[model samples]
Target chain A: MPDTPFIDDGSNVPLSELRWPDDDLTRIPDWIYTSDEVFQRERERIFFGESWCFVALEAEIPEPGSFKRSYVGDVPVIVTRDEDGDIHVFENRCAHRGAEFCRALRGKAENFTCPYHQWMYDLKGKLMAVPFRRGDHGEGGMPKDFKLEDHNPKSLNVTTRHGVVFASFSESVESLEEYLGPENLEQFDVVFKGRKLKILGFYKNRLQGNWKLYHENLKDPYHATLLHVYLATFRLMVAGQKSAMICDESGRHSTMASAKDDNIEIGEETASQMKSAFREGMELNDPDFLNYVQEFDSPWTVTMQIIWPNLVVQRELNTLGIRHIVPRGPHALDMYWTMFGYEDDTPELERQRMKQGNLMGPSGYLGVDDNEAIKYLQDGFKHSHSQEGIVKLEPEKEGSTETLISEASVRALYRHYRQVMDI
Target chain B: MASTHPAGTNLSPEEARALRFEIEEFNTEYARILDEQDIDFWPDFFTADGFYRVTAKENHDEGLPVGLVWCDGRPMMQDRAAAVKTTMVHAPRYLRHYNSNVRVTGVDTDGTIHSESNYLVIETLMEQESRIFQAGLYIDQFVREDGVLRLKARDCIYDSLLIPNDMVYPV
Candidate 1:
């Protein structure tokens, strides 16, 4: 008999059929963005394997019994705070018939009862009771020894740092601090420094592109100079600014940091290079929208951290938020944006934050450009006969660089991606 | 047209009908300008200190202060209009606004009118079918400037939770 390959899902294409176009880190094959086999493997190896995916913020479910619907990969999960004030993460599927019982996006619940079969579960995801377990006056009761504990829904290993929540499917996943190494942790702490967070609101939008494109967009500072006119015109981030793309040793996480310079003038050569982005007479009618209140101790005015696979922590001047990427398929993804502020922020600061929010989200001055570019990339890959997309700018470098003309962070991401996917 | 009616006096049946007709005419012109893609003139529909915000129904219900498109004054709106017109890059599309159920909820002592209207926006991208983009309620406060109704505040609370890609233009 022939040796059968392991195929967990019946619809997934075999892994042997997919191939990388070349071994070079500068060239990315289009199949990685359009293959179902690769997507399934990524789900198995990265999102569901040894990765601590960010699920929710502690401020979202601040009180006992407060629950929010979230996702680990594409699978649905529930993040809850029990009566003991301990956080728990469990699959939303009912243990009896595999029904997604918790329907609301978020709410406070004492206990969950599956509407299909009436199987009840506690806040900790323990099976508390079952309707008609004795089956109508003992006519047809449960078999001899059925244990309530055995039928509990599958739960995950939950951990939190500062106020951010993360969940993992692996039992022996490393500590959150160790996962985000010392260098990455230093930048992470700049935003989450033990102060209470007050969530302002949310912005949800669906993009017609793969989920990883978002990470690439943040990592590739090459695009920030030419693509976003608002960033370039307003001098929020330009080519000659003090910027660094800091990637961790594992290459899975990165922080693209840049400081704003009000007095810096664009040189002739640099101005010629960014002709489309930098306008000569462009000025804001409301200059207060560009006000940068110095709140953080860090020197960087913008620190966009891509925390591997699923989360993006955004600190763009005074505006602060976290973007949770949920992959729908190979070609589509949904972004859930949670815009927040600190509890001690004054009314003026809050209003400032709100005004500066025009630079972000789906309809933002800078954000819309990226979304359109990603969509165009996806359309090109899907419709054309191109086999590979080039990422060869500053080709000699790999992890981090000081120049804005490099794709070192993007190349670093692919290097890590190739190892994990075993391509 | 001078009248014997006091500032806080209730309008007669004929007066209420005339006021509704005038407000509807204003809304029709507003929609026509937006649908025609004359965005430079969009800010002129509001007073100098008018406020405009577009937020989800969920956030409005929860009393969340954030807005998808938050403009505190006409200057901010003008800035947004300029960005969307000249700087921001987005796919070209056409949007048509359909507003109905215009109701004059109340009238203040200073002749400021508070009204509500249901709105629907249908969008058509290049070489794509026209689809419903957003459906919402416009909670508005209008005050006359030189006998012309100008929006003092327009709060667009959308029912669609997940916006498709981007909403480049104002609602």
Candidate 2:
């Protein structure tokens, strides 16, 4: 038999190999996490190919001329609002030699001038001036053929909903509403609630693993009550909690809604009986730290909403934020998390949110635990080169299930991945 | 880390030499404890009501209040130590913190010493070469109690915007 190449850059790896074994959405191959070819295909077909990717919150560029540079996959783009108070997104590349036009993380400017060649562009990405367009003297001017109108930077179809900005490179992509679907749209609204978002600050980190691993980590809900001892020990979540894994019809987005097993009296009794996660007689050193006042009409104590391609709007017990993903390559990616709240929030509420924020970020009490687990997950795939792995936890039906111990949401992500990549 | 009577960031020749030696020794000891992973004694380095926070310089410059790790008192710091010791699971790594350029900026009349120093933490994972993990300025406020120096506040403002993997221990 021909020696099967266990390790490949994914060029020679056949498209047939991309298909899940036995056509099972629950089965994921290791190669998907390791293939550069797969990453490029995803960039082309998923990111640049007909998807509304989250760029910036409307609040980030609230004023006219205010702009923030963001990424859709690996392609950097500028999100700016013009003097007309309309949001627009375009490639940050300069028209002349493709250097980045907007270099700052954020700033306000009447227009942008590329440092490389002094190619000036209006706030809306219209080419306005060129350094040598008219030349030193009229005698050296061009043949009167270089039209500035023809050389404007490439722009995208952009929209702002509930102070969240989304841009799509493909004009043919569905409206942001249709793309998010009704389920995700409802959850998004629940988080945004028409309140103006405030850019509190950002927590950024680079994970030395596949970008999908983060998604997989969120979709894999079973690991939560096991790994994050803080959650289980506090009865914030447990296997017996009344939870649900909600996947959209498109299978591209998902929301995990978990109501604190509310029966904590009984939950704690059961937990105290358990040996590993729930130890007995543990109390918060500062009970004030758990001073959460539910501001939402929703019942879920913790809601992690995953928008297709790149956005995660999170509400972890009054701590609200968005997690944005940028794929560095197949093996690594960056996560920029912006923690925020409403502008009119009370001082006490803001303090509560800030204190509660400790449960998240690269060093969060609960968040760091997931990183370690995902690192372990990536380590497993780096060596195991398995053709297909099992995910059939509560796999009776795939879209949404009323259980926390299910990998159906992860399967939902891959289902959309297969359709978009045409595997 | 603390310093005694490094008044107004100026001193006589003898006092300057003595203060420099004291502050340098204080920093060296602080770094050594963390590097040696004597986490139990970590909180004792701080005053009873001291504050500790680790935030990115980006956030600090923007005046953002959130931190990767924010502890309000020695109790909270000790709780963090306990959590890191018993609860957290981290891959085996050796961490060594280097503190340099200790500058005592000012001294309050109440014996609170204000100092700043540059720090670099080198981490070596099992079977991996050591890498510069974090480089930042230790913006500190120190106070003395019963002639013993203790940290009043430590703001570890990390300049590197991107945190690698996860943070298992305090900076």
Candidate 3:
């Protein structure tokens, strides 16, 4: 017999090779979702170990002294704009010990001072100050020379393009744009719009679910039509539109997009039933669904741009925003949603964008449902089951695809996840 | 003063009474429309150039600034409603808006009335099982036109810092 992999039990592969199920080859073991051990391994192997993650947008820290506290994987990081306006990302923990240096979410700061001791460092991660260096007595004093340069927080490599900022722990990782791939890059530019932006606002919510669930939510386009019925009922998106769930080459990034179509009329009964079921009133003013209709040089009415690891850019009709998922633990996540409009947006157009903004966020009809659904998904995984959950809704194709509905992109996400995690 | 009408909204005692009645009726109708998931009726609550904002207290005060949802003009609001009803999908649920402490604020030179009110909304879903989905407050500002009260701007300030789940409907 050929030398085969053996089980932990002393039993040889000949006895039981763990017969793989052909019918459900795409399914992942349910233990991954519910096991603490798996989550811990994932943190070490994927998050802390390697992989490029989106930490912040270049637009967030435009000024030279501006800085925004963000996270990569589970590690806290500080992305700052130096005097030259170059962006830099550094671990938020102090080098002396593991104390968090920056507590504020965002602000302009010249130097980062450690709260524990008076150790200070400039924005460039260069040590600037150290208190009580020339001590009083010989016993209390340090040796002939003490260098502050030896104690600066470690930093990850950062890259910014078209106003988006990305970082990576792995030196061998490809260029940020290359890692993003074309499909995701196109979706990203849809809202980043290749211009300066004015930060409209930020919304943060503590969700009681796994962070991966949120990523899966964006990759799975089938849920959009059903999860955000408010979008359909209001005639913003229709089944007749040419929509698609696209993924990057590495299957790490995804874009769920669709065009606006008003020609597809619904039956009176169905329309009325839909309208009645969601009661948010379909008729606000007139049926000017095409109100903010400046043609975007793109294919879809909206793009839920899923950047691998953390960021989700929602390029909705006229409004654009980024939803950053910061995981606190296996069962908790903090969703930081930042809404934005261009600096050149006319007051009227800005008003319209703000109005449409109501359709998302924590209170928005569509967003609330997504929050609730993901929670339920995690809740379901609490129980053990013989059958694993399936994201294999469309296994017939690979890469970019067509169809108003399909969870193929989500399956692609899992494929990449398994690859990265070496599962 | 906490009356049936909002404060600073220039409504005479008698006018306040009538306006209060109309406002109460409007709130009830609005809730019914949402409870029934009537997306078509959603836009009708605002004026042609009205504003609708659902923002968090943290964002509003700290200037962290982001709206849960925002609609500047009625057209955008209408589009949202149409989209949600026609294209969006989620588990069905019933939304109940319980509005109280309505006080009329200052009335603008134009018939626009600045009003503020404290309201509580609770949502329950029917999945063959009943579940409390969300509960929050509606902080609103309105205007009266030709004996009709129209919501000029309604900002939903949810007391709970963390949302229970996804809020599928506007407050």
Judged by DockQ, which candidate is best? Answer: 2
A1-423 per-residue lDDT for model 1 (tens digits): 111234222224456876676588888987787778788888999889999999999999999999999999888999999999999999999999899999998889999999998899999999999877877876886775988999999999999999999999999989999999887899999999867999999889989788899989999999999998888888998999999998888888999999999988989898899988888779999988998999998999999999988999999999999999998777778999999999999999999999989999988998899899998887776666647888989977898888889998898999899998999
Writing each residue's lDDT as its tens digit, candidate 3 over A32-95 gives 5545655676677666655677788777888898999888877899999999988888999887
| TM-score, one value per model | 0.95, 0.93, 0.76
Model 3 misplaced stretches (Cα beyond 4 Å): A1-25, A137-146, A234-240, A265-286, A289-292, A384-386, B1-50, B57-66, B71-164, B168-171
Please give, for residues A1-423, the per-residue lDDT of candidate 2 as tens digits: 211235443334545446567777767887788776787898999889999898998888889999998999889998889999999898999988999768788889999999888889998899999877787866675458889999988999888788888988897988888888888888888988767777778888888688888888778778777777877767787777788777789888888888875356635555664457655566666667755688887888899988878888889987888999998877778888888988989888887888788778888878878787777776676655455678888867676887767888788788888887876
Residue pairs with colliding backbones in model 1 are none
**CA lDDT for candidate 3:** 0.70
Clashes of each: 0, 0, 81
State in Å the error of residue A268, model 3.
Answer: 12
- Per-prediction DockQ: 0.49, 0.51, 0.31
The Cα RMSD in angstroms, rounded to one decimal, for candidate 2 relative to the true structure is 4.0
